[model samples]
Target: MDDLFRGKHHVKVDGKGRVSVPPGFRRALEAADPNCGPERNATVYIAHWDGEPFLTCMTVRGMQEMTEQVRAMHPGDPDREALEEFLYENVEELRLDDTHRITMPKHLRDAAGLEGEMIFGGRGDRFRIYSPDVPKPAVSRLAQQMSTRPAGTSPFALLPDRPRPPAPGPRPGE
Candidate 1:
């Protein structure tokens, strides 16, 4: 969840609602690890859009893994078919043009109501597209939300301490 993109770039949406995916962000997608091969191709998954008036782009890897896991749980059940369709249908396969711009299709643009000014933020393995017209909540307000958690709210914190819990001790019968 902490996969927030560190690179920031300001860009505008054209009259057609198409916005360029800054080269820096494209590079961010190409290299999941900062120090890796210079591959340029990246898999992109355009979700239906979420989080109050914003569109979210998830890494193709993230989307595939999530879909596969969910599908596996249901076996041959038809219930998962709908989810599979939803993910694939909404996902927009993307590519960088000669100018290194990742085009946003008209349908997606319309879905998110993007017009002129927009904000792009790296969201872990994917990215988020937001209309600049919308006002974002102040960081201080977010900090306050984080500060109000219950004391033992964490699962890991509730686990009993195993004071050295008997070592391997020669596996069963040494």
Candidate 2:
């Protein structure tokens, strides 16, 4: 929980599609990948699903967690097959260089229209890379709505309520 990917970064893409990975994100990636050390560069999995305008990037452990989830489903099930495809296909494994940059493949760059300045927005365990020219994501609108809610309201309210313990029994005096 302490190593969550947080904040946003704006970086430029070079002709060869190499871009600097933010230091904070690099640390998180290193923490998630047990194989990473002074002798090894962190390996990241980049996933671009469908025609989405951004590439989803995560550490090896993150990808493994996704794979495990998909694997839990029944074999040959329609949804399971789709999930397997989602986890296994359309992904590129990239390793960070000593300079802390990753050279994204041309196809991945083209699929996301990634060029010029890119927005690397953190999404907890993973991050998304996209061009700044595109329309704002729908979640941004939800963020705007957040301001209207009461000051103490938390976004976690959107999730199902956690179970509560039973009230304590009354004392003998009652």
Candidate 3:
């Protein structure tokens, strides 16, 4: 999964709840998933972030990679059932148009309290679209949590394990 999706763009949440994904952002997305078929079923999992309800998109492969790791760690054991349920409940699969637009579901919009202005933020393997006004407490809390967390604890730890590359051979001419 690509880990460098950082950009900013204006988005307008239309009356029908569709947002115009910026062309530049779309290009970045296309570059990330070159093998995605022509009729892209860009499976995305959006969530509210940075004080607003923002949409996040990712390829299905990315999401699956994430989930597999979680399964490895927890395995849906009774002790981890809640975590498993939370993961299942939050992630969503959506289709993106050839135009690179995604229609926000009403429940998601309503949960985020999105109305007019929107912000699309590319965050590596995923992107988040946020409402104009995000709750200050939420923002501060996330900042504090992120700041306090240990460096090794990634959100993707629950995903399937990736094979570590082999060590480099002896230096050339050695």
Give TM-scores for every candidate, taking all chains together and pairing residue i with residue i: 0.63, 0.81, 0.64
Clashing pairs in 2: none
Query: CA lDDT of each candidate?
Result: 0.62, 0.85, 0.64
Off by over 4 Å in 1: 1-4, 32-40, 50-52, 76-82, 137-174
RMSD of 1: 7.1
Q: Name the candidate that leads on lDDT.
A: 2
Model 3, span 66-171: residue lDDT tens: 6786777756477467556655776566666766777888887887776876777666666666665865444233455556768877755546799998679987
Q: How much is the lDDT of residue 118 in candidate 1?
A: 72
Candidate 2 structure quality by residue, lDDT tens digits, 113-156: 88777888889998888888867753254476667788878887
The deviation in Å at residue 133 for candidate 2 is 0.9
Model 1, 97-162: lDDT tens digits are 555566778777766667777778665566777666655552123335545767546545446787
lDDT of 3: 0.64
Measured with C-alpha atoms, the lDDT of residue 67 in candidate 1 is: 79
Best by TM-score, which number? 2
Q: What order do candidates take by lDDT, descending?
A: 2, 3, 1
Evaluation by TM-score, superior candidate among 1 and 2:
2
Off by over 4 Å in 3: 1-3, 31-35, 48-57, 74-79, 135-137, 140-174
- What does the lDDT read for residue 143 in candidate 1? 37
